[model samples]
Target: MTPPITYDGRHLLADLYGCPLLGDAALIERALRDAADRAGATIIGLHLHHFGEGHGVTGVALLAESHMSIHTWPEHGYAAIDIFLCGARHDPDAALQSLSDHLAPTRIVRHLIRRGEAP
Candidate 1:
């Protein structure tokens, strides 16, 4: 079997632990935008939704290369971020760093998966 050529890309799973400002949807949006910018990714559109005050926030940035998503739990002081960008033009690690800088998580854990890899 062979993998499709179009499947090539980088996917980053970022876990922000002991983070703050998870309830701030506006900040999260800004962070996402900054992350995309830092990664040199083009944003076609973006959307953010806040569950409620003192609750969680969900945000997604639609990029030309792919997408970046964030789900926050303010009560738990945690945020889960996923950044998947296609092609080699974008740096998903920079996006993750941007998110960490904006949110200032006490601890961060991340994994990068290379897409389109043959089994």
Candidate 2:
């Protein structure tokens, strides 16, 4: 049997297109940290990985509420991002906007998921 899913929080999934220079892990990390702060979320830790020169980056910011993560494809000019927070006290949409502003993507598709819901 599959495990049940939770709906006690909000999760924002985003696909960013037409992004320029997606290989900078440090910049993405900073942007996420700033976004978390703007959303009034307490950040616990952050982890980031760079694929290689002119390749891509993957990053995750562990927050007191939950976590936010991002992966990029410089060659394709695309990025996938997830901003999941465990309560309404923080705005995941606002955090997502902050990241969009920092990255300046030409197109963005975002979806919000309710987590920890009763079965």
Candidate 3:
């Protein structure tokens, strides 16, 4: 008998602090794209939402493997991030680590999920 194949998906929930209010949207989006590229995931599209008056932005990057997304509230000193990827050569954990390191969140809550079924 043959064993089923599986892929790893990591979901991260983070509480960020001391993040820059203005111009952080582009920085985060860029970091995500870089991480995706390092993980061997192809970037499809990215959308960023900027709120007025230092509120922050919500950014989402769609990848060929899956997606990486983030929502920020600089005023409250918080951010929520999620990264999901499914493929043979993609490493979702590396992507998650890259984001965490870039953001430098003071408090972090992370979860890992293994997805898909046997062939």
TM-score for all models, in order of appearance: 0.93, 0.90, 0.77
TM-score, predicted candidate 3 vs. hidden true structure? 0.77
lDDT by residue (tens digit), candidate 1, 1-119:
75556666999998999987899988998999999999999999999999998999999999999999999999999999999998787899999999999999999999999998756
How much lDDT does candidate 2 score? 0.89
The Cα local distance difference test for each model comes to 0.93, 0.89, 0.73
**Cα lDDT tens digits for candidate 2, 25-95:** 87898888999998889899999999999899999999999999999999999999999998667999889
* Between candidates 1 and 2, the lDDT winner: 1
N/CA/C clash count, model 3: 0
Winner of 2 and 3 under lDDT: 2
Top of the candidates by lDDT: 1
Candidate 1 lDDT (Cα, 0 to 1): 0.93
Candidate 3 residue-wise lDDT, 40-116, digit = tens: 88999999988866787888889888888888888776777777777657877687677767776666666666666
CA deviation > 4 Å runs, candidate 2? 1-7
